[model samples]
Target: MHLKDIIWMGGLLTVLSFPVSATEIEWPVYGGDNLHQRHSKLTQITKNNVSGLVEAWEFDTGINATFQATPVVQDGVMYVSLPFNDVVALDAASGKQLWRYEHDLDEDYPICCGPANRGVAVSNGMVFTGTIDARLIALDAKTGEKRWDNRVVGDNTGIREEVSRLDDSELGSVSGTSGAGINMAPMIYQDTVIIGITGVGYGLHLDATDSDSPLGAVVGIAGKYGRRGFMAGYDMKTGKQKWQFDTIKSKNWEGDFVTKTADGVELPRDIAKERASLEKYSDAWRYGGASAWSTPVIDPYTGILHFGTGNPSPQMEGSSRPGDNLYSSSLLALDANSGDYRWHYQQVPHDSWGYDVASPPVLFEITIKGKPIPAIGQAGKTGWFYVHDRRNGKFLYKSEAFVPQKNMFELPTSEGTIIYPGVMGGANWSPVSVDARRRLVFIAAIHWPVEYKLHQQPARNGEAAIRYSSMSPLNTPEKHGLLTAIDLDNGEIVWQVKTENPLIGGVLSTASGLVFTGEGRGELMAFDADSGEKRWSGKTEAGVNAPPITYSINGKQHIAVAVGGNRLFGFKTGQKIKVWRLP
Candidate 1:
């Protein structure tokens, strides 16, 4: 792929609009654009020629952490953020480093999840990113020089360090150990950059019977540990906060305490018991853990920024804090300009199980009942693709379960209850791709079931009162990844592919009738977008746990992905970015 063929002859230093140009393609945002579609119009590498794709170039960032950043390309320059918030700019056509920005973080920063960064956002003349220290920073796009840095969280004192030390250092010891950190790519809208925090609601994870195998179990210990999660918009020029929207609503946090979901799915919630304790736990929303783990997608016409929220605080045990846990485990729509709440559709209310809406919400138009309507769709951890009216947050039809569903919404028992699509989810943090022309949404899912067991006895160390759940993965033979193609017109799954390992990364679809995704087993495969037939597969040194993106340099299309496997999930880890093109 040479840069001269499709490169629009323009000033080399010109700061162009997001799309870059008419002939040259650019992946300018986290989701390629504000719609979060993860789709490209380039078709030079079509299905017929996809098998001939060969390695174009590869860049090693030299740091080997859980790499999940999706490189953003624009005007022959590609920007990628490595784990630990290090930003690197590279030439899109060749594997050459342009500049690098090294971020310095405090040693004592609180972090609960794996050290992974999503990517970086480039706008005007600056590159923006959020860090593991809960800070937002912007750098000069040309030289990779720091422009401005601002802290996202106000105070870290809210972290529970005192209460955690008590209880014989077991029941509440997890608090203050790790809290809020920024792991997602920032979104640029107008003059504001949008970002959010994650890991605040995270609990201790227990190793399986064998550390070398896949995760055996997870446990969400109860405590007032993390702070309330939020998403905010900041002034791009000054890095000053413009507006903020808390995921947990302070006033109406309880809402109507509905026992069923908006789609009429009966949630196993004790409404009367929750209401009886409402007053005592009314202020729990202040410390509620509804982390915003995905980037926000904006509707250019309506100015609504949509994203999903994580699980509520003290995950898996809703005894102390109850009443629907408003907004957590929900699809939230907010006014992009003012950060005002618009509407929310909760996926799991008073969620005792960790069913976070971790997938990025995709925006598109769907025809329902012979009527076209603006809509947003999200592949949920609950094993379904949920569709909703983008204008009013109304429930549109949902696709059939892409993965196997067994004992869904069933409460954890003392004897250990099995839940399909467990904590790893039907769709975890992996992003989905949409093909508007084909009317199909490509989703990467996991079929791992977890054994959820509630523990009512005191800690073995005779710690404070203990009541929580031990979520262990059933490392049996049936665990695998499900790559599904769902037709939006009739909510039917057209084709599904199963993999030996769970699909934790993201997906990309194109006009070339191809779908691309990475597997936990270190393979990058391209499938026929229409028939779900495997067209080509290449092995990277590490697992490709990040999303795949396509862009054009000299009329030759190229596919790029970061091959840093996930350590938490036992996927091999490395620090490599591989780009492929037609030979």
Candidate 2:
């Protein structure tokens, strides 16, 4: 049977087993459903009537930070997390506030990125959120009262001490140093809440001087600074630890020192030099930075969970940490119940370009040679849409470049090298939308190029010599966005639409033949899913740098999104959740 038929039968079985109200459709999961499709089946608002959409209601969160949460709805109640990890439950039909939970963060902890919480997960009358201070808390879904709070990690003073010992010049143009925290929405499977850590990858972020401009740069310094990252599951009832899977393996973390990607793309590596120095950094896995940047998507039938990992420590200068860096920059599969490793596919071996598998993976079925194969797709920062067999993590194929590509996988030089789809990505941590029946995947991508320059400083004042690299996106008029549709069957670009600013958030597609996405320029847009034609645009008070979600209440369709701008990209930040519907 086709994947669409499987999905339809699954929904039918769900409805037969548990009677659901026909008038109410809830977006219960972060990515619409367990498959992480981000595609809605609602069709009340069609292409012809989409232009008639107007603001139905709006609720201000009273927080002005990088708001990136994708709101979740269930049983006529909407749950969303603010940039500071505070969560509020709102009435789905009206904008009335039901209750709020104020997250108490530790003021002394070092935060790698600015205050940004992707969202919350609701299950079994409990609302779960990962805080900026690296703690996971569960709140009573109805009363917003805290039930339990579990600290994921201890004080990160060791990382801070290592960073402090580095020379000032070796740190490069830095706005912030690396630290540990949680940024992704928690994923619940059965009785476990799964989440991962971020900012463990040693790098320095440069903030834009102008509050309305994009980021300044991302610098990678060579040193032993960050701790290993991991994803762990916790008991739902008591918040007790269940199982943990470290992104960097404890044994043989270096692997076979392959000179190319698993899919056969050659990389620029000094294998001889790395092999000779393996013993020098044999214990690098302790500080090997493979931060988990996004949430995991599971296959219910097989009990396998798939997710992405971030870059290795010391970021772009990989001299100290050699070899393939094991699980960093790779797609990982694990047994959902036990956290046992199943398989992995590294996209960048011995990576030094900051190409992290930061986007969430989408699961579906594809027919190959008349046999239905479980497939997974991830929108990569390296300007490609990669497809793989979900069951065993086998690379199937990669789509045509969705954005411009130049000097890819090239080593940095003192004179600097220009690369497209730089650190900000062809796709960042944004979730993608998939239309299974249409065999198309929608992507919201960025088209910014960066000048990759290497810096070397000699020893001074009894300090050791240091080397690092700085990646600065060219502040040119050409930086923009691309909303692309790629054919899943053949891995081809079906259509693309360009925007004035680089896309930062995500995309949402509906069965009504409409695609929705937000822009950094304060506009939410809809397009013809088949042709990529703009159908409607609505102005917002702040940058709509978050994914748009659609659902129905009382048989009436509505669209909603978080309207706070991203601070790292320097968009206009605000504190509002806007809902719209056709009039």
Candidate 3:
């Protein structure tokens, strides 16, 4: 096998030179491996036998909340994180609980979205998880006992006060106020466990009036409301800070004011006005919001970490922050060892449309123009799967819009501008799966259109007038979901499937030529990877609003996923991890 076929399992480089037995197959990372491919090599559950899969076991976390964890398995133990950041060790074969570590959150700790932890990272006999209170914790892999706890950030006084002062009436009916927290699964690179902070790109998320409906709106009030976000590395054993990379650049944030994207998509910008007001908000980067929304994929050969950044702060209204936001709404590459900036590809410059590059990036080798190149792909909220040269961040090509996109990059007007793949995203924090051998990328995406409206309120209570913007899904279009497979070689949709509701979680691809993903209606469905044929479907008690992972224990293959629904999208919430296998 070639060097490109080597897989990094929990920071150790292992070459896939020969076929390993099914018993040795285990999901050791959030995306199945360090490449974040989310592909399993075990073939016991082939397409022919997938329809016969039956429930093998189910484990309830007992804390019903928005569960989005992707369980990691190694040896015979499955390590999973709960909605409240609690860690649990389970017997992978029977879903039997071995040990549990309850996370003790600070009573006054600030939370943005509900307690939704993506998952945990296990390395060197320790399980690492980032808490909703901005703390990094390490637990013994054997007994689930605490090893070390490090606070990623100490001061949240400013953000807490700002959130407290937010007027609900002015912001509409919000479900939660944005505050700093850590929700992403930590990534282990060598001896350092990497994680990032979220909610720094503060925006008030409105709640849907109907309990079963999707989100209502995301309101962005114009002011200094958030602090800069960062992704840092810490020692896995001691939880000591190694280095930090700020998402927003303090200086030279205003890049070349390009009127269009690299692909020639025109942007609506007041370049003249922005240049004139540049000096006024000169210190804007201090509070600039570009929250790290997902786990990064590292190029083991190059030692470069690739990840995405969220929308700029004060969210939708960007008048106060001038020029192209350097790092926000972009794909960034940094040195994994030193945390030094390598390159960045900004998808939306000075973005006011809330088009965050929120999806976790996937790395693979692609042949471009007869030359094999190390490439990285990120499914963007802008509705395009962006492919770039992973080594130097070169724009290669982007897949056709998987979801319907109308009036993209349009600035909000007082009357309201309608846009598909709005704040909720074309591909939110969901991770994509890649079948390197087939050159296909599977993505779970949303097709909900939202109305972007600008609001200007009159001066009241001795305060000055306030201007803001809001995004809410439009009822007329009717929200839905799309599971798309894009050919990496040609950047075209190979196959696509539609679902009744928006797909929020992630995707799993298997060597059995099967693709698995969940729906908001609580069904785990599998599809033929080559053709968009629905092969099988399994119903769950709650919405399967998390990624599915496949592993083999005792030579028996099993598929598992966290079954708690997402609160932001108003999916039916529960507390269960369901596993299935061919009986």
Candidate 4:
């Protein structure tokens, strides 16, 4: 009964007006609200009964590999989060573990993406998480007990964090690697949780200055005594740090660009990488492309705080630095109480194909030519679906619909807009659903043209060396992965449903017309949000890449998922969370 006394008695019964219950069973966070739009206006589980459903329970976290989080639930309880940073709490109708905190991780942090944790941020009774060994714990949401552990990026930062600390025969440097952290799922926003660090900077960029990416941040801790990251506030009741935002724009650029050292000699920076302990304090911390990695859409009706930025690294190339790099892959619109900015919408301006707008923008409200406005519609991977105007970022379109585009600047007009659903567009990171009472919105896509193969590796005693670029072989074939259907009054797309193993998981629509999803092939189906047909299926022995939730509990109505392991196969079904319900 304490989520601030249930939001102060649901805002005092909506100001003595009563109403407001709207089906009470919660899915709580991740994309259920804070406007992530993995929408769910509760439809009593539809598609004419989702094929009579089944399963109702399955748990086995036998410690597999990459279980992309997303379980959350509350009141009835269920928290999940495992991949290396482990965190457990279950009882949402009998899964029973009730508390398991496992966190010792030290195989030598290399992580491009593996020990991924993504799920757990409950607040009030506690239950926070973020650690690939980078730290940010917080438990006890009913006795998981630990209450605080904020390390927030600390393997040591100063004396080169003690010379990258690796004694004992240099301990093979970080053997088998388990070392890096945070894969997503941390947005409390009021007691200040914020998080956003999925990599890139761990190698540093303005030619990588050193220490393991201090230039790729978004921090903001403070739940109850553990002060961390850039530090600012939280002394209130004692979570520590009250304010801080670092971005000092520094550069190295490996002498603007020129390398040839496999044996030749042109050394500049990344001698062998890992440097960035929050150095530049000013040029706004410009080291290279931004890295906010999805999950940020606050808008309690515009107290405004949106997010989505990435791919400005050496991963792909916009030649080098160039303009339009402001705030990195752009979409920011801060002021969530001083993170400032307020209005940006670049969606791949100089982007280069590591396509940044990492997905999950969803904020809702439709209408275009007739202008109903109030939008925030994202769906990117640089393949495009943009939609802006979340109170003033406007792009309701006079043009802005891109694909296979190429204006390369120098334009009096068309400089960028060709975006044929390239980097897994229409949706990626699985999560797109909005019923708004059946006005409809349900995404799922992946159409190919991955393209991006830059490469650079020779900055020896000075800096800049570990470039990391390779991706352009996702030929999913069969027309590639769509689920489309747009027309929230006129942006037009209206009917799509083309799949062949390319939906990328996370979607659930109801009002009883059904549209559940989770299938990169581990099945878990049901369609027909209005003629997409197909109606029922189930498999999930693995690969559905998380994101699918629906509830009811005592009255029945299930349908959940999280088949585990992602970043394209990591956790391997061994980490499970599967539900179905109907009987």
lDDT score, residue 544, model 3?
A: 90
For candidate 4, lDDT tens digit of each residue in 1-583? 2112223564574323332242235688887666666655555667677777888788887786556678888777778888777788887776677778877775655544446566877877788777765566777788887767766655532111111212122112221111234567777777676665555423212212222221121111101111111211122123444544331123432222223211132322332221231222122123443555556768886677777766544334332343333445556666665565567666544344455666667777776677677787766654446676787786664112322333221111112233334444535666577776567666776664433333334566666453333333334353356777565544556667776666665676766777777665577777888888888988777777667787666766576777863534211354688888887
Clashes of each: 3, 0, 0, 49
Query: Per-residue lDDT for 1-583 in model 3, tens only?
Result: 2223777899999866665743338898887877889988778998898999999999989988888999999888999999878999999999899999998888686666568899998889999999888999999999999999988987652252243333545455553345788889999899999999988877666554432245567787766767888999998778889999999998888888889987789988889999999999898777788989888888879889998998888788788888887899999999999899999999999888888888999999888678999999999998899999898999999999999988888888888888877887899889999999888999999988888888777777787776777887776647899999999887899989999989999999998899999987899999999998999999998899999999988778899999999877768999999999999
- CA lDDT of each candidate? 0.84, 0.86, 0.86, 0.55
Supply candidate 1's per-residue lDDT for 238.
Answer: 97
Error of 3 at 104 (Å): 0.7
Greater lDDT among 2 and 3 belongs to: 2
* Stretch of 10 with least lDDT, candidate 4: 218-227
Clashes of 3: 0
lDDT of 1 at 214: 41
TM-score of 3: 0.94
Better-scoring candidate (TM-score), 1 or 2: 2
TM-scores, in order shown? Answer: 0.92, 0.94, 0.94, 0.31
Tens digit of lDDT per residue, candidate 1, span 512-555?
79999999789899999999999999889999899999998887
lDDT of 3: 0.86
**Candidate 1 — which pairs collide?**
216-473, 217-472, 218-471
In model 4, which regions exceed 4 Å deviation?
1-71, 78-126, 131-135, 143-152, 155-183, 186-292, 295-309, 313-354, 360-381, 384-430, 433-441, 444-493, 496-508, 514-528, 531-550, 556-583
